[model samples]
Target: MTRILAAALSSALLLASASAETLKDTLPHISVTGEASEEALPDRAILHLDIVADRLTATEAVTENERKTRSLSDGLVRQGVPIDDIRVVGVTLQSVATEEAAPRGAHGKHVSRGFRARSELSVTVNSLDEAASLLSRAIDAGSNDLRGVEFVVSDERTRLERLRIAAVKDAEQRARNYVEAVGAKLGRIIEIDHQEAVSATEANGRTEPLASASGVAFLRLRPGVRRLTARVSATWALSR
Candidate 1:
């Protein structure tokens, strides 16, 4: 019985290996990667603000924080910012000593600032020219921390499609370069896969990891130029 079982296992292994060999590509092929990018001025500005309050008691801190948020919202509404455009994405309360209240290295050992309340605010401001002024106004309306503004394109679907096409063309060119160098001909593409899309605000293509094709990344998007980068991996048959 043991010998019979061993024979069956050996046969199964041989059959599986044969199946894998049959599926393996025997044709000569080349694999290459391509990348491309395009830049445009961001069309929208999203402001990030933090309203924070510290007091002897948690209730007092929370109440003060709430008042500041209301003041900020009302001020923006008065400046023609729509109510729907202002959002409070997060809120938190904690007992800790902040750096501003401490003197250098004194982290929380001897200094206590009491309970702190914070509200994270996200505001959409459409006018680029008004961004600087909006920050000033937000401060006066009770924002304690200016986290910075995110500039984005309202719609990027059309632009991203262009980047992808360019990336594929770039891959083909690279494949051709190698084939021509070797005195060979480039044949039809066997497989193509979209690898990555980096939507960055700056030139370095570093910042946030974009979500699929539309994820957000912070790059050098300085005031005028934002970059959208795409990459593709592809395989092509080598023509004889």
Candidate 2:
């Protein structure tokens, strides 16, 4: 019995050692990150415009805002903008004080009995050439609240797919370099993680109306190349 127990313990120890060696040989304890980027031009633009009306009564404010919003939508459609692209974001009614909450120097304070209402619209413009002009026309047609414009790529999936391939290659190259430096052969990849990033450049401040609203003016929509960056982390097995 004593001899059998000693043999069993020895066998267990040898098995554990072999397992550890196998794990050390196959598993990659080294992790490496690689990044790849591609430049692309944006094909779509999102225009956020708001039509606001402030009146003594909430009903009056809402009525006025609806009328103006309708006019703006019609004008945009007349200017060749697609009807389906227009979306109403929100409509709000809020009370305002006609009289100063605190008394000003001389004038007797008058209190407001009504509310103000505002309507917001978001339009997605597919054509870059028509974006600024359409916005200007919308402004002319009673769109007072021009929030801003955002440019984006319509076919982002294709770009990201290409970037993913490049990123994986880059990760593999980095892993190879690391293993070579450490004097080890790279084995199969054990794990991989991938992520994609999108970035854009835009003109923010208030823009003056172009001299020609209908004609194609030199709209310097210098959309900087949107960089689709992909980062991949790979764990490569190290072989002796």
Candidate 3:
């Protein structure tokens, strides 16, 4: 009986020591989240313009729409804009009922009067100086539907990489501060996770039609500052 009791007590002691070691291994790390933002003026401009035409038949409407789009494209090219930067993004053709077509019929049936055709174009201008002139020329070329305008940096990828580094540095600094406050020194990074970058524009709103007298003033419509933010969550090993 004494021998059996001694063996059981020894096994229990070894199990307790193993559990204590596992707890220590899991609790010796620190984690923190950090975020940072950078702002820069946009160097590129993207303009959205549309051409709409209505005619007695679908074929006539489509032909007119194509003619107007061609005119707009040629006008931009004449002003030294690159042909590769201009692209047709959307096209639509649908029959529209005019008042004349809605006249009461013997069988109370509605007739289709004409068809409307619309074409949307997306233009990317590298130089801010040419943004206003390009838009004005497109409007003069029969592009009456001005949809929207967006400003962006052509080299945003490089800027975002720099912000990522800054965010990691910011996290390290915070971890060090916390470790120091607890009377310990910072150690190697055990784990790291980078969050997606959030991008925002300072004045991202639809622009109104340019006044006939304010052609040059359109250049003053500057693409305000663009802000890019980065966040990171990092875990570092703790050291005494």
* Cα lDDT, all candidates: 0.77, 0.77, 0.80
lDDT of 2 by residue, 1-240 (tens): 999999999999788667655765767666788888877787677888888888887788899888888888888888888899998989888888766555566776877767777887889988776787677667767888778777878888888988888888988888888888989988866667789998754434224445666574433343556778888887767788
lDDT of 1 by residue, 100-126 (tens): 456677754446679999999999978
What TM-score goes with each of the models?
0.67, 0.76, 0.75
Residue 180 Cα positional deviation in candidate 1, in Å, after optimal superposition: 4.9
Ranking, TM-score, top scorer first: 2, 3, 1
**TM-score between candidate 3 and the true structure:** 0.75
Q: Comparing candidate 2 with candidate 3, which one achieves the higher lDDT? A: 3
Q: Which of 1 and 3 is the better model by lDDT?
A: 3
Q: Model 3 misses residue 1 by how many Å?
A: 69
Highest lDDT against the true fold, candidate? 3
- The sequence of per-residue lDDT tens digits that candidate 3 reaches over residues 1-240 is 999999999998778667545544786877888877888788778889999999999999999999999988988888888999999999999998734334465344457889999999999988765777677677767888778777878888887788788889999999999999999987767667787564556567334445457543343346667788888888777889
Q: State in Å the error of residue 90, model 2.
A: 2.1
